[model samples]
Target: MSSLISIVLPVFAVIGLGWLAQRRGWLGDGGAGALNAFVFRIALPPLLFLAMARTPFEAFGQWRFLAAYLSGTAGVWVLVWWLAPRLGFNGFQARWLTCLGATFSNAIYLGIPLFETAFGALSAQPVILIALMMNLLLVGGSLIVLQAVSGEGTRAAIKETLSNPMLFAIGAGLLVSWFDIALGDGADRLLSLLAQAASPVALFALGVTLGVAGSGVRFGRPQWVLLVAKLFVHPALVALACWGFQADAINAQAAILIAAVPAGSLVHVVAARRGTLETESAALILLTTAVSVVTLTLLLEWLL
Candidate 1:
C-alpha cells in the first residue's frame, strides 16, 4: 500500500496532469501525437537499444516467461473469440476488437513508467522480451489479419514489423552484444539521457491522448465485459501461467504487471484506421486505464 501511494500514485498523477493539461488547452492541437511520435521514433529506440545491448544472452533465454505470457494471450484470444458473438460483437472486425481489447496491453506507455519505477534498469529485460513477442506476433499478426480480411498481401505486414525502429533497435542491440562491441562513454551517456526521458514523457502523452479522444462512449455490457477481461481475467491467467512455468519471482511479477495494465493505445489506433469499432476501442482505452488504478494498486500490494 505504501508502495502504491508513494511510487504508483505519482506515476498516475503525471498522467492525470497530462489529461488536465489537454482539457485546459495547454497541449494545443496535435501536441500529444507529436510527443508520442518523438517517444516512438527517437527516445525509446535508443533507450531500448542500450537496454538490450547491456542485457546478457542468458537473460534472453527466458522461454518460460515467453510461454507464460503467450499462453495467457492465447487464452484470452480464444475466450473472446468464442464469447464475442454471443455478446453481440458480431462480424470479424467487431469480434477482433473484442479479442484485441482483452489481449493487448498498454505495455509501452503506462507500462514502462511503472516498471522503471519498480524494477529500475532491469525493467528493460522483460520489456525487450515482451516487445519482441508482442510486436512480432500480436501486432504484426493483426496487420496480417487486416490485410487478409481486406484482400491484400500479408507480406507488407511482415515488412512493416521488420521496419519498426524499436524492433530495429532490439536487433541492432543484440548484434552489438553478440559481437561484444564497445559503445564507449559518449554514446552511453547520450543513450542514458534519451532513455530517461522516455518514461515520463510517454505517460504524459498517453494522458493527453485520452483527454483528446474517447469523450463520447457509453459504458454498456460489452464495455463491462472488456473491462473485466482486461483488468482481471488476463492478469489472473498470466499469473497462473507464470507459476505453472516456474518463472522466477521477478519475471512472474513483471508478467503480471504488464498483463494488469489497460488495453494498448495501438488497439484504438488500429480500429480508427480500419474504420471499425472506433467508439468501442476508445471507450475500452479510457475505461481500462481508469480501472487499472485500482487493479494495479491491489496487484502491487500483493506482488511487491
Candidate 2:
C-alpha cells in the first residue's frame, strides 16, 4: 500500500508542478510539443537503450508475458471500437478515436517514473519493454485506425509512422540491445544524463500540452465514448488478461500500472492532424490523466 503511494505521488507531483508552471506562465503555452519532441527524440532513446542493455533478454523472452500484455491491450481496443458505435459515434470518426484512446497510454512520461518508484531499478526492463510496445502500437495501430477513421491516404500515414523519431529511436535501442553493443564509459555517461532528463522534461511538456487542451472546446458523444474506453474498459480488460495469463507479481503489477495510464496526451495532436474529434481527443487526454492519479493508486495497492 505504501509502495503504491510512493509510486503515484511523485508522478502526480511532477505533473502538478508542470501544471503550476503553466498556470503561472513559467513555461510558455504549447511548449508541450517541444518538450515531448525532446524526450521522444533525445532523452527517451538512450533511456530505452540503456534500460534494455542491462536487462537480461532471457527474462523477458517469455511469449506468455508478451501475449498477455498485447492481448490485454487488443481486447480493450476492440471493446472501445464496439462501444463507440453503440454510443452513437458512427463511421470513421468513432473507429479511429476509439482505437486511439483504447490503445494509447502515457506510458513513457508517467509509466516510467511511477514504475521506477514502485519496483526499484529493475523496473526499467518492464518499463522499457512496455514503452517499446506502446510506441509500436502508436505508430502502427494508431496510423491504421486513423487512416480508416479519417479515410485519409494510407500511404501518407504509413510514411509518417516510418519517419517518426520515437519509432526510429526504439528501433535503434532494440538493435543496440540485441547486438550486445554497449555505450561504453564516456558515451554511457552522456546517454545516462540524457535518460535521466526524460521524465522531468516530458512531464513539463505534458503540462504545457494540458494547458492547451484545457482551453479547447469539448464534450459530446465522442468525449463520453472515449472517456469510458480509456478510463474504464482498458483497465478492466488488462486486469482480466493479467489473471488469465497467471502473471507473476511483478508482471501483474506492471500490467496493471500500464493499463491504468490515461490516453496519451498526444492523441489530440494525432486527431487534429488527421481531422477527427480534435477537441474531444485533447479533453479526454487531460481528463483521464487527472483521474488516473486516484485510479492508479488504488489499483496499484490492490494489484500489489
Candidate 3:
C-alpha cells in the first residue's frame, strides 16, 4: 500500500496543482495551451528520442510482448469502432473519437512517470517500447481515420502522419540506435535537459486543460462506455494476451499497466484541431484520469 501511494500520490498531486492554478487564474487565459505546446513540440520529443536511443535494439525484439500488447490495444480500438454507431456515436467524427478514447493510453505524460516511480529507471524500457507502438499504430491510425472520414485525400493524411514530431523523434532515435550513432557529451546533456522537463510540465498542463476545457463536460452513457473500455476492457485484453502468449513476467506486467493508463489528452487535442467531438473527448480525458487514480492504485498493488 505504501509503495502504491508513493508512486500514485505525487503524480495526481501535480495534476491537481495544475487544475487549482488554472481555476484560480494563476496562469491566465490560454496558459495551458502554452504548456501543452512545449510538451508536445519540445520536451516530449526529446524524451522519446532519449528513451529510444538509450535502449538496446535487442529489447525491441521482444516479439511476444509486442504482439500481446498491440493485439490487445488494437482489439479494443476495433471493438469501439464497430460499436460506436450502435451506441449512438453515429457520425464519423464520433466514431473516431470513440476509437481514440478506447485505445489511446496516456503513455508519455502519465505512464512514464508512474512506471518509473513504481519500478525504477529500468522501467522506462518497457514503457517506451509500448509508447512507440502506441504512437505509431494508434495515433497514426486515428489521423488516417479522421482524415478519411472528413473526405481528405490519402496523400494529405500520409503527409500529416509523417510530419508528426513525436513520430519523427521515434524514427530518428531508432535510426540512431540502428547505426550505433553516439551523441557526444554536450549533445547528450542537451537532450537530458529537455527530457527532464517533460513529466511535471505535462501533468500540470493536463490539469490546466481539465480546469479550462473540461468544466462543462457532463458525464453520461458515452462517458461510461469510454471509461469502461479504456480502464477495464483494454487492460483485460492485454492480460489475456499475456496469458496466451506466455510473455515474460515483467514484460506482461508492464504491458498490463500501460494498458491501464487513462485516455491520452491528445485525443482532446486532435478533436479540437479537427473541430469534432472536442467536448466528449475532454470529458473522457477528465473522467478517465480521475477514475484512474483508484484503478491505477489497485493495479499497482496487484502488479507490484
Top candidate (lDDT)? 3
**Worst 10 contiguous positions by lDDT, candidate 3:** 153-162
Put down candidate 1 lDDT per residue, 25-88, tens digits, no spaces: 8878988889899999989898789888888766777788778988998998898899999888
Kindly give the stretch of ten consecutive residues in candidate 1 with the minimal lDDT sum. Answer: 122-131
Candidate no. 2 TM-score: 0.88
* Tens-digit per-residue lDDT, 1-304, candidate 2: 7767777887787887777777777756556667777888889777777776666656667555556778878887777777777766677665766677667888878878777776775576775677667766764667776676556667876776677665666567667767777677998899889988987777767766777677756666666666667767777777788788887667767766787788887677777766777776777787788888888888778765
* C-alpha local distance difference test of each model: 0.84, 0.73, 0.86
**Candidate order, TM-score descending:** 1, 3, 2
Q: What is the descending lDDT order?
A: 3, 1, 2
Show pairs that collide, candidate 3: none
Where's the lowest-lDDT run of ten residues in candidate 2? 57-66
Evaluated at residue 12, the lDDT of candidate 2 is 84
lDDT of 3 at 244: 92
The model with the greatest TM-score is 1
Q: Which ranges in model 3 have alpha carbons more than 4 Å from their true place? A: none
